[model samples]
Target chain A: MVEAWQWVTKHPDKLAGWTLEHIWIVSVAIAIAVVLGVALGIYISRPGKEHIADSVLYLAEIMMTVPSLALFGLLMLILGTIGLKVIGFLPAVIALVIYGQLPILRNTYIAIREVDPAMIEAGKGMGMSERQLLFKVKLPLAVPIIMAGLRNAIVLLIGITAIAAIIGAGGLGVPIFRGLRNARMDLIIIGGVSVSILALVVDGLMGRVERWVTPRGLKRR
Target chain B: MIRLDQVTKIYPDGTEAVNEVSLEVGEGELCVLLGPSGCGKTTTMKVINRIIPITKGKIYIDGTDTTKIDEDELRRNIGYAIQEIGLFPHMTVGQNIQVVPALKGWPKDKRSERAEELLELVGMNSAEFMNKYPSELSGGQRQRVGVARALGADPPILLMDEPFGAIDPITRVRLQDEFLKIEQEIKKTIIFVTHDIYEAIKMGDKIALMNEGRLVQYDTPSNLLFKPKNEFVEQFVGADRALKGLQLIRVKELMTGTPPLAKADERVVTVQARMEREGVDCLAVVDNEGKFLGWVDRVNVGKGETVRDIINRSVATATANAVLSEALSLMLSSGFKTLAIVDGINKLEGVLSFDAIQLALSEVAQRRGSE
Candidate 1:
């Protein structure tokens, strides 16, 4: 860990770029996941979604079952032959994105569906149209739960992003993977420490957000 | 005015929630739908806003064909509050309250201003609460914000579904009283749904009692208590209904202690002549301050004594919202036929008599029978 800190201090500029790119990939992918996942959750959680939602959920569950590193390899093969030039990190990101869905989709489905039926009745009684109820009441209340899912997704993605460095997606993991291959203990410690710290910081920030936004009634902590 | 004509709701699987319910709520009247679970009280409310679209019959709000209107537009015009106090956790209280107004296309300032005013109306400090998130508030406080949010756009109709159900019993009663005060001021056409018979009788101007998807009775709270529509209503409304009826009926509605009114300082004969003319045994004494000095027993009056000498200073009073039992209990204990209705300063307003109570009961009974 100390050696990793020395490495971060040793190559501040390189660390900065790697950090930025790594975070950028995680953020963009997570952002896309949130939108698509929440939309799908809402769509699936609604009444009469029994068959369709169950099928999609089954597929997501199956995808979640694949090991992350192996999934990345599969994505590499699938995308490498396509016109995609960002192939090195492509497989990594796709695997992380897929991995991120378990919590998010599960939470989204629960959040949207778990809104008190009485509250929905009240929303309707207030003369709120279906659209108003969905976007205004249902969506807002679902936010905390959705955020919960997102929090898990983001932290999971951060940790998973490090392993992608093996495919030339040289994040902080570059030193970790490269050093380990050459049996360089110092470099391995550097990459390992940086990834752990990244996960810790991201996880801490999401904890603050959850505390700030989750309804006191629903607040777990 | 809101009218439900033979409204019935049947789920897809063929369970009837509300069965042939027909009733009309007067404009600005607070009508409570009280029943046990699965009694159709909630379904009746849903049918009004078309949440669960009426499977049979029609609903008219202010005499309009409500069923023909777009559900959302209609909901925007009516305020709905729930027992869960569903204030959107993601939004500030101000934002939550501003929802309907914004959707109604009011100017931004108007929406926010109205939201603030509503917060204040529900006893929340608008400045303190407006920017704070919902998670920062206590359960009772959040419920108040929920009410403020519901009342934000000034909808003529407000629907409350066990709005205080989640709160502690003490808080529940407090919220109910606060709501009653708001109701007195706004006089909106309200449909409050509750399974608690006591609450329904306490808060409702009129109570609609339901059983097994059927409306058992629709009448004034006191009337429903004094006269149950059937064994179902009698059983549902509870055995202590006569006592509940007294609580439902207010002192003003039932009392007739019209003590002789004499100015603060007047000749002793002024009290005498008025007492003789009104045929009152006692008089309510007042001062130049308009403060109630107490009561004047005619027995204490002498041929040439000052009014002060004649007035009995030990007087009991009741406020407008004081339940009938309190005043009646006081009157019975004190051995007085009249209970003074006064404000906080103890200024005399009116008096309560058995006649008033009898009158309210008879009139409500007559009206209920006619219906």
Candidate 2:
């Protein structure tokens, strides 16, 4: 414990760099996931597309079942064949984004689908065009639930991002792997602790964002 | 003014919701489309605003064909409300009420001012309710906000499909009365849809009674009650048509102007002699200015020196403007054979009697029989 504390204090800059890298990878991957997932969600949730939505949701569920490391390996292989970087940031982001799809996609689809039909009817009756109804009524009402999914994707990506170090993606995982290779307990402890703290801080920030974006009328007193 | 010329709506599934229904609602008229569920009353109303598109025929709004206008533009000019209220839960009451105005690109201050004006018009205090969400409001309050929202842009035409249907019975009646009062001031040409017979009678200047997707009869509430076009119309109006007709007649219409009355300073014996001459058991005692003081009955006339000495201040009285149905209920509940019809300040106007109400009903029956 004493050794771990001293090492962390002495190498604060190194710790900060790894934490920033971890945050960057997770943020970028989750951002892409949100766009793709929400767009797909809206597309699939349109009327007469229930079968397509069901099949897409099923595919997302199947993708979620793939182990993170195995999915990363699969992406590495696929990207290598496509003449892209076989290891590091590209594959790591790709893997995290794939993993992030289920929560964000499912939530967006369900949130949009679950909006009250009567509200949509009322909007139409009041002369709101289809586009106006989507932006003004449906999307605003779906924000809280979609944010829940976003938070889930973000937290999941942050944790999984540490594993990217194996492919030389360079996050807090680098220290833990190096510590294991050299039998350094203090290094491993610092890396593990930093990743945990990073996940918690990011999750807390996302929680605040979720609450902020939620419509005031939707909030429970 | 709105006119439907043989408007027909047959859904894609081959269900004819509104079949060749022709009706005209004049400017500022509150026309009720009343019928049983699945009778296409709601469908007929929705057709006016093109919410449910008509498959055949045409609707004309103030001499312009509805199809000639852009649907959104047409709908924007026609205020719409439904039974569910459908108030956007995420919006504040003010925001909800300002939706159409905001859509029309009104300046923010103007839109908000309109919302405040409408909220007050619906009996909601803007200060207390402007920022509150629909979820925070009670059902009746939400309903009022729904109505306020419908009147947002001050549309000359309004389509209300059971706007008060979801409220409790007492609140529903209150809301209806308040809405009618609002209608009087705004004078918008409104097409109100409801299944409740009493609501149709109370709210509609003219009722378009539909059945099985066809116009069964279109007439005033009194005509619908007394001169039903056919057996179906009579049955639909129900067996208690005469009693329902009472709802249409105001107390002042049947009330006798020459009511048995005694001055507060008049001798009790003299008032008793007058009551006997008028063939009434009681006389409405009034002050010198004709402001109603109380009542003096034959039984108490002999025990007092003056009418004021035995005046029964608890005697039930109705306003001259009150419907006979209200007067009847007040008389029945208060165990009075006659009600002194007074003005707002309790000045004696006339007397509404049980016998007069009976005579009114028999006269209506005789008129129906002669017809």
Candidate 3:
């Protein structure tokens, strides 16, 4: 423990830089996943499109069942075969984003479903067009649930991001990978502890953001 | 004013929800569409607002074919309230009430003022309730908010689908009373749907009873009770149609002239003599201006005391405009044979007695028998 703490203290600047990089990559991946998932969820959830929604949800569930490491390796090989660069951040991010899509898409579908059917009737009865009902009533009510999905994605991606360093993504995962190659117990412990601390901080902040964005009437007192 | 000429609605699953039904509701009239579950009353109402498009036939609002006007615009001009209320749980009472006005792009200050005015109109304390969410309110309060929201834009037409059906019986009665008062003031052309016959009789100027996706009868509550066109309507209105008919007669119709009154300052002996001279056990005590103070029962009078001191202040009373049914309930509940009918300022206008109510109903029965 003393040796690990010493190592962390000795390379504070490098650790900080890598932690920032890790946060950036995960944030981007999650952001993209959210946009794509929410759009697709809304599309499939429309009337006459329920079967499509079910099919998409089933596919997302199957994607979630695939092991993340194997998915990443498959993506790396596909990118290499396609003659595209596969050694660094792009493949890592693509893997994280693909892995992040299932929760966001599934949660968005469930959240939109959670909106009261009576509310939709009320909206239309009160003269709201389809667009207005979706934007003003359905989306606003679904947001808190969607944010919860985002929170899950954030935590999951934060953990998965550490693994991204194996492909030269240069995150906090670098130390753990280097320590594994050299059998340096101190570096390994420092990486593991910092990643945990990083996850905790991100999770806490995401929770606050979720609460802030939620409608006050829907909030837990 | 709203008119429906042979409207029909058929669900996509080959179910006929509303058959060809033609109806007309005059301006400022409270028209009730009443029926049992799956009787197509709700479908008929939804067709008015274009929430459910009619499968056949035409509907006109103020002589404009509904399909000619923009559906959204047409709907915005018509107020709507439903059984479940559909209050946005995430909004405060004030925000919920301001929905239509806000949708119409009324200035914020005006919308806020309108919300407060509507809250007061619905008998909720605006300052106290404006900031509270729907979940914070009881079912009755939320229903009130639903009504206030519907009236926010002050539209000339209102469409209500069992709006009070979810409230408890007691609250439903109170809300019915409050809505009647509001209706007298606003005079909107209202189409209210309900499964309860009593509610339809109490609130509607004309009741349209439906069954099997078709309107069976459309007429005034009294006409529907006294002049049923068929056995279906007679059975639908039930066995106590006469009692329901009596509820439509206001106290103002059957009430007799006010009884002799004693001034509040009159000596108890003098009041007692007045009651005895009038051959009555009690005399109403009024102020010098003839405003009703209360009533004095002979048993409570003391020779040395004044009428004010001997009066029963807790006696049940009714307004002259109150329906005979209201007086009947009040008298029955309080064990009073007569109800003092007061005017707006509590001045004694007349009295409603059990004899007068009996006489009214018996006369109607006699007229029917002769016919």
Candidate 4:
């Protein structure tokens, strides 16, 4: 613990770089996950898709069961020299994207389903088209929860990102794997602290954003 | 005008929410669908706009089949407001009001201008609130914004689902009063859904009582109160409730002033003499053309000043369709017992009082029991 504390204090600039790399992975993953996951979640949540949700859930479960290492290895094997050249960032990103999708999709589906029926009815009563109801009323209200899931997923991704160091992803994961290899406790602490700080940072920022989007008091206007 | 012929809504779960209900609302009339929650009042409303597909039936808006219009095109032409006041939290009041107009692809300036106008119409007054976010508003303010957002496009028809249900009683009464006044001026065909009987009576030009997914009774507010078709309608409308009928009686017949009026130049002493001769407690002060100027109390006028000089200025002269809840509140707040009712042109219509309400409710109740 002292060693980790000393590393964070002594090499704050290096820690900052490590933190940036950690954040890079999280933000990229979140951006992609937000777009794709939310869109997919909305599509699956739409009416007449009860069966499709089952299929998607099954597929995601299968993906979740795949070893993160094995999944990246497979990407590496496919990319060959190309994989080694980009420092294997693609493999890490793909793996995190796969793992990050579940919470987002689930939250989005539940949020859309859970929106007060009266609101949707009001939209329809006023002659709102399905698209309008979904976009204008349902989706906006659903944003807070969807963002919650995204936050959880991104924070979770920060921890999982350390595993991507195996694929040579340029992040604090570098120090982690290097420390593990050389049996250097100081490098490991630096890596772990950097990753944790990244997670806290992402979670905190997203939390603020969620409050801004959803607002707290009823008299927000 | 809206006409629903044999409209039925059957959820995929084989549950029927609205069962072969047929109803009609005339143009320039306000209609309320009054029922307990889950009584299909909401489902029936959704079916009109095709939000939920109808299992069977046809819906006509302005006499045109609703199914024939493009869903987006049709919805863009209709305004919707709900009790939760679903103004997008991410949107400013102006942006929230601009959604429909933007969807309709109206020019940017026209849409923004329209939103401003609607904000004013709903009493939010855009100049003060257009830039505000939904989160910054109180319940009543949010509701006003919701109404303004709905009215942004000025559609011929509006659908409101318990729009004022979430506000505090005081704010609710204020919003309800303003809504009634706006409706009088706009006269758009409107379908309103609410569980509050008082709200239904006050807002609906015609109220449709629904029970178990079926429309039990549909008629004018006074007619429904006077002649409920069944025990269900009567029960739903509530029995032994405090004078529901009083809210329905038009204010025109209740004012007790015996045709006392004063010209712009009429002296205080002259008006007092006229009041004494008529034995009237109040005088309807009007301009030369007989427009509703304001109200003056005969008992409170000072002998030393003109009738106008000493007359108590009050918050009356609202449209005759205003509810007793509002009238009573204004009276109580202003420490006055009565308010002058006005017509569309601000002409003297009648006066409203708590005793007058009781008398009207009693008469209607007696009449209903006899019927």
Best by lDDT: 2
lDDT at residue B165 of model 1 (Cα atoms): 84
Interface RMSD in angstroms for candidate 4: 3.7
Candidate 1 lDDT tens digits, B185-260:
9989999999887778778889998889998889987668767778887777677555665666666555554456
**Each candidate's fnat, in order?**
0.56, 0.69, 0.67, 0.40
Show pairs that collide, candidate 2.
Answer: none
A35-143 per-residue lDDT for model 2 (tens digits): 9999999999888999999999999999999988888889888998999999888999888888899999999999999999889889988889988998999999999
Write model 1 residue lDDT over A66-159, tens digit each, in one string: 8777877788777867857445666666777788887898898988888887667656666566677888778777878888889988988888
What is candidate 1's TM-score for chain B alone? 0.71
Stretches of candidate 4 off by over 4 Å are A1-39, A54-90, A103-114, A123-139, A149-155, A167-221, B12-16, B35-39, B166-174, B195-198, B227-245, B256-319, B323-371
Model 2 ranges off by over 4 Å: A1-12, A48-52, A179-190, B250-323, B330-369
What's the distance in Å from true for residue B54, model 1? 2.2
The CAPRI-style docking tier of model 4 reads: acceptable
Tens digit of per-residue lDDT, candidate 2, span B1-371: 89999989998989988899999999999999999899999999988878888999999999999999998889899999886559998999999998899888899999999999999999889999999998899999989999999999999999998999877875775677668668879999999999989888878899999999999999999889888899889899999877787777777788888476788888888887888788978888788788987778888866879877898888777766566777888789778787888764678888888998988878767766776
List ranges where model 3 is wrong by over 4 Å.
A81-84, B255-296, B302-322, B340-351
**Deviation of model 3 at A169, angstroms:** 1.0
In order, what lDDT does every prediction score?
Answer: 0.78, 0.87, 0.86, 0.78
List the per-model TM-score of the A chain: 0.88, 0.96, 0.96, 0.87
Candidate 4 residues B281-317, lDDT tens each?
7777777666876657776667446666756556555
